[model samples]
Target: MVLEKLSKLIAEHKDVDPAGITLETTLESLGLDSLEVVEIIMEFEEETGVAIEVNEKLKTVGDVVKLIGECE
Candidate 1:
């Protein structure tokens, strides 16, 4: 469920196809800059009620999923 929502959010924000997004997809590969990443993180936090700290560790979609899972 988290992956689905996150993928949709990323696809909408980046104007890409959600079907193309995967756990291994890197944020940089999607052309997401630091500010864009932060914005997405904030949006996800609000939606999921999971506070995510912006850091170097959040490089891939899987990373974010894992963090959200851990938080929950």
Candidate 2:
């Protein structure tokens, strides 16, 4: 489920290398601009049945994983 959700967001960039997207991959390195990141968070909420607030706090990919884990 996480892969599917992430792939949806990752698919936006042609240069995004799949192998580089580990749990530790940063959003900036993944080419996720602020708007794309918000869309990703929204997609995750819809996909995983989790509600995430759009705040300035979550600034990394690890932050996203932590938020999803908290939902679980």
Candidate 3:
């Protein structure tokens, strides 16, 4: 569920190919700046109704997925 939602979000917001998204994918490699990540997090929280504490250490897509799981 997390992967699906996150992939869709990235595809829509970042113009990324959802099929290219993988757990190891880094946000920076996707050309996402810090502000963009913040916006994505905000949108994610709004959509999931679950607030996420954006961690600076979250460097990979997998990290964010783990975060969502931990938060839930």
Candidate 4:
């Protein structure tokens, strides 16, 4: 679900290698700039029914996965 969500998010932007992203890749590193955080959060809310407060503290993709798993 996470990868699907992430790939969809990236597809909304530019080309992304669905296989390129790994658990260790930070969303920021994938080019989801800080400004796109809100969009990503909203997508997660819709896709997983999770509400997240995005901030600099959310420093990695793992943080997002953990947060979504926590929602519920």
lDDT, candidate 1, at 10: 91
Per-residue lDDT tens digits for candidate 4, residues 1-72, read 775676667656647776666667787787777777667778768877667766576666677666666765
Largest lDDT belongs to which candidate? Answer: 3
For 18-72, candidate 3 gives per-residue lDDT tens digits of 9899999998898888778778878889998998888788788898899888887
Scanning candidate 3 in windows of ten residues, the lowest lDDT window is: 32-41
Report the lDDT tens digits of candidate 2 across residue range 1-72. Answer: 565456556665535655556667777777777788788778778877877776666666667777766766
lDDT of 1 at 43: 92
Give Cα-based local distance difference scores for all models: 0.85, 0.68, 0.86, 0.69
Q: Which sequence of candidate numbers ranks them by lDDT, best first?
A: 3, 1, 4, 2
Candidate 1, which segments miss by more than 4 Å at Cα? none
In order of listing, the candidates' clash counts read 0, 0, 0, 0
The regions of model 3 sitting more than 4 angstroms off are none
In order of TM-score, best first, we have: 3, 1, 4, 2
TM-score of each: 0.86, 0.68, 0.91, 0.71
